[model samples]
Target: MRRDEVQVTLLYVFDELESDLGGTVSMREHSQVPESVTTIRDELRDSDFQVEALIAEGNPADMIVGVAADRDVDHIVVGGRQRSPAGKVIFGSVTQSVILDSDVPVTVVSVDAEGEGGDRP
Candidate 1:
């Protein structure tokens, strides 16, 4: 990035399978931010990076791409675990979807599997 350029990390939380049964149930419960997401946001803030956090409920890939488009983001960075092509098909991959589907430039970083991959934000 150039010295004049600024990067704002957009933390988007997506609850894909949520459903409101004929408006009988409230979806406010899904608004809660995960601890891991908060941790990442805190870390980025501490590191002095511009950060914007948003909570949304929808297909993860679609939301990610939508945010990038809506915000006119210059670049997108996503973390992913190493996997074979067959593994990707079977397990499904949000990283793959965003990279292939997005019109903006995308950078993919490998995730560390030391403790848990769930902590990726």
Candidate 2:
């Protein structure tokens, strides 16, 4: 598809208290405007597509679904974390919720050090 025809919005979700609880958190504290979204926006800026970055609060799955409905997005892209078999069964998956509830198509992207599609190193 033509770049002009591509309209995309990147949503980055972060815990609200990550910054405040700083001092040895397992995950690095991310910005309100996430770096990944910024990188994507920068990469797409030269293209003809329209790109937006959204940072939201509350449960990740719920926020994603709500935004997808509110914005009427063609597709919702989310970064997924690989879960242990036990975790998957116990907590249920966030992506599953979005896939089930979204009015629009949802694209779940798994992230890793090597990039999308690669397993965690």
Candidate 3:
């Protein structure tokens, strides 16, 4: 989809309730988030997409899918981290769950180091 036609919603889910600030706050007022989200936001700001960042505390996968469904989003694009089988088993995979549960099309972006050599387009 063309960036100008599609709205980009940057979703950040805090697995721990305490990690999310309960009150409403603009993105500028919020200090806690993965650095990648900030970087992506900056990059998107340079592009044509209208970006909106959303932060909530809950099961990451559930929150993601719920938001997509609630917003009637056309598609969901999420970042995934490479992890060993053991790690996946221990922590579970949020991307995996989103892919499996989301009704809309889902694009998974690898956030692993291997894709970081000026990978973003």
Candidate 4:
């Protein structure tokens, strides 16, 4: 990040039920902010970056792209985890949807199961 003014929005989206066909489901009902989001914000603040934290509930990919568009952000950075080919086919990736749908440039930070790999600025 340049020394010039820059604002970073740290957004975390909670998954919501996809359909009403199933009986009432309950889990993750509360809207508490995730510790991971707070930790990331703290790290960014420590690095002298201005940060805004936002929590949303919805389809992750849609929410991410909507926020970026609504906020008019210059770029989007999303984290993804590696999965087996079968798993990938079974659980389509939110990151992939955001990459395909986002108007702004997207940077994917992919990590392994051990969280050992990712590109960093």
Candidate 5:
């Protein structure tokens, strides 16, 4: 589909416990408005797509699904971390749950590395 025709909604899941505890969390601080949504919107400003952002409390998977269903979004984009074998089993994968539960198509992007470069456009 054309960029302009795409209806994209970015869901940022924040845990209140983490925020309240004052831990060194990435999404809790940097993604208050959901950085992914802002980045995509700014990048695609010239395009015809409509970008919306939602920050919700609770688990990421449920919030993502809820927003997708409510917005009737054509696609849902979520940012995730690439976990190690042990980490995957221990923490599980939120991206997996979101992809499985979402009514619409979901795209998971990994941005774990610092200097790693990829073609965003």
Candidate 6:
């Protein structure tokens, strides 16, 4: 499907960290995110795609699924990285989690070790 035909929301999830006091640490006010998101939004806009950017703080997979549900998006696209079987078993994967949990159709685009985009193997 062409990007311009669909409304796009670019979401950036800031992973919540645990503080020394055992409280949730928020990066909602992070400075770099705005600029980064803007750069991405601008690029898509340049490409003639309708798009918007959103920032949410929490687990990446959960935030993605939650935002999709909240926004009533028709589809969800996520990036996946190659991992060894042991690594997959130990660390799990955000892409995997979202695929399993999301109600909408999901698409996974894999990135290679050099950060080049590719179809998932």
| lDDT string, candidate 2, 2-120, tens digits | 88778787776553333465743323244445456676688787766788877666566887888888888888776777888999898778888889988887777887643344543
Query: The CA-based lDDT of model 4 is what?
Result: 0.82
* Backbone steric clashes in candidate 2, count: 0
TM-score of 5: 0.67
How many residue pairs clash (N, CA or C atoms closer than 3 angstroms) in each of the candidate models, in the order given? 0, 0, 0, 0, 2, 0
Error of 6 at 116 (Å): 4.9
Greater lDDT among 3 and 6 belongs to 6
Q: CA lDDT of each candidate?
A: 0.72, 0.71, 0.81, 0.82, 0.68, 0.83
Give per-residue CA lDDT, model 5, range 1-121, as digits (tens).
6777776665556754445667534556544464545666666665666766556776667877887787777777666777798998988787889888887787776665542225566
lDDT of 6 at 13: 83
Error of 1 at 64 (Å): 0.3
- Tens-place lDDT digits, model 4, residues 73-116: 99999988977788879988888999999999999887666534
Better of 3 and 4 by TM-score: 4
The candidate that wins on TM-score is: 4
- Work out the TM-score per prediction: 0.69, 0.69, 0.78, 0.81, 0.67, 0.76
For 1-121, candidate 3 gives per-residue lDDT tens digits of 6878778889887764333557433443444677777778888978878999888877789999999999999999887888999999988999999999999999987777643423655
Clash count for candidate 3 is 0
lDDT tens readout by residue for model 6, 78-117: 7678999899998878899999999999999776665446
Candidate 2 positional error at 78, Å: 1.7
Please tell me which predicted candidate would have the highest lDDT against the true structure.
6
Pairs that collide, model 1: none
- The model with the greater TM-score, 1 or 6, is 6
- Rank the models by lDDT, top first: 6, 4, 3, 1, 2, 5
